[model samples]
Target chain A: DAGVTQSPTHLIKTRGQQVTLRCSPKSGHDTVSWYQQALGQGPQFIFQYYEEEERQRGNFPDRFSGHQFPNYSSELNVNALLLGDSALYLCASSLVAVSGNTIYFGEGSWLTVV
Target chain B: AQSVAQPEDQVNVAEGNPLTVKCTYSVSGNPYLFWYVQYPNRGLQFLLKYITGDNLVKGSYGFEAEFNKSQTSFHLKKPSALVSDSALYFCAVRESLEDFQKLVFGTGTRLLVSP
Candidate 1:
């Protein structure tokens, strides 16, 4: 079975430009979470989408936003991207149930903001 | 607040030797600990997890982790190391309850298994 998948494996955008990254959750997963991994650092939680709604958010600015479709697919959108926005954007999917969930990550979409 | 810590920046061990990657976590309630490995430019791969029952959890690639509640640590261990086992390892934890399951991850530790 195909695991979580992300689109635009690599992208380059000039500062102040906008970019949109897409993700399709695993076959049985209903929740999607986004993370940003900068060089020499751990992945930072961006936000989580459940039932097509944002349930939790991390320490990110208004420029970063996202949407989750009814099918549980997700898209992360960045407006007025800054040079510091360059990082590997990871999409993880999980099935939220009575038991605690275990998240599985995708290969990640690398964004380069110039 | 829930958090996780991986004290070592990197650990080097000779192939065929026992390998250990240290991890520690802090949480308000029972913790759901997890370990993941990442290769260069790739996503984190699920290694193993500790939720309930046994404290010594076995996982992929002949790796296992011991969950120490008293010390709030879940250190990854393998009996023998291989050059291919060298990669970045991450420690993460979340409240085991239905709610408050957002994962809090450590900075990660790079393990180098040299031949």
Candidate 2:
């Protein structure tokens, strides 16, 4: 089974621009989560989506938003991107029952905000 | 609040030698600890976890972590290090009281296994 798949392996955007990253969950998984990892830092939780609704969120600002389609695919959108937003955006998926416990991650999309 | 700490920035070891990556955690209620390894340009791969059971938990890639309650530590260990085992290691903790299931991760430790 294809684990988690992310699109646009790498992206470059200027400050104030917006970008959208995509993810496809692994087979038989229903929950999707996003994380941001800065250089030399561990991954930080951004938000989680289940049943097409956001179940939990981290300390991120409103500019960072996401949506999970019925097909279990997810999209992470960042509006008015800041240079500080440049980092590796990771997508993780797991069964809803596992919830906040066990999850698998994708390779991640590297976002470079200039 | 839950937090994890990987005190060492890097660890150097020769092949065939045993390796240990130290991890300490702080959490309120029962702690769910986890270890993940990340290779260059790759996502983090689950290594092992300590939920409830024996203090010695074995995980993927021949890795095992010992959970010590007194020390509040869960150190990752391998019997014999291999050159291919070099990568970035992360320790994470999840507090049972927290609803988000969010994991607070450590800064990460880089392991270098020289052949």
Candidate 3:
């Protein structure tokens, strides 16, 4: 019963570059969501993916995008990265059901935009 | 728009003393409230959530929260604090009527339990 897992636990990228963060949802989970946690602040929602389609998105710019595979794994891509993009990217997974479900999160990938 | 508010930036309490972290929210419809704890350099860990029934919800790590509909508040509480309980606590809200649940988080409150 492994929980949500994220890849590239820590990475660095230069300005104007691109980065992709990967996430594997918890066992028996289907929906995947991404969040950005800046220094000294709580996480802000980026977007959510279900059935291989983006269902809802936050106020992020077009530079931020995501993909969900059939296996419920997800990838978050950020293009033209800026220094402000440097933060902890968290991946959360939950079940899409009528009732409220707990969203489990991964340790997150630390992105350092240089 | 739905939003969450954690008024205190930081809270300190002596070990073995009771502790409380306050939270308030605003949403057009019914809200699904949640509390999460984050350690340094770690991701958010789910503590508890208030969905429908039971205004008082008990969660992991000896934490509990009481939902007050009239005040739109859900304050996290613990009967006795521990040094290890020190961490950043966040309050989040999601509207029940929303088709896709996306949590709106507060600015977060740092809790320090001193010996």
Q: Which candidate number would show the highest TM-score if scored against the true structure?
A: 3
> For candidate 1, lDDT tens digit of each residue in A1-114?
999999999999999999999999988999998999998888888998989888888889989999999999999999999999999999999888737667899999999998
Interface RMSD of each: 1.7, 2.3, 1.3
- DockQ, each predicted model: 0.63, 0.59, 0.73
lDDT of 2 by residue, A55-100 (tens): 8899999999999998989999999999999999999888866634
DockQ preference between candidates 1 and 3, better one? 3
TM-score order, best first, reads 3, 1, 2
Model 3, which residues run further than 4 Å from truth? B97-99
For model 2, report DockQ.
0.59
Model 2, range B2-112, lDDT digits (tens) per residue? 899999999999999999999999987888899999999999898988988899999998999999999999999999999999999999987872354467889999999
Per-candidate TM equals 0.97, 0.96, 0.98
**Tens digits of per-residue lDDT for model 3 on A54-113?**
999999999999999999999999999999999999999998874789988999999999
Could you tell me which residue pairs clash in candidate 3? none
| C-alpha RMSD of each candidate structure in angstroms | 1.2, 1.4, 0.9
**Judged by DockQ relative to the true structure, which candidate is superior, 1 or 2?**
1
| Tens-digit per-residue lDDT, B31-115, candidate 3 | 8999999999998899999999999999999999999999999999999999999999999998873445589999999999999
Q: Candidate 1, clashing residue pairs? A: none
As a whole number from 0 to 100, the lDDT of residue A16 in candidate 1 is 95
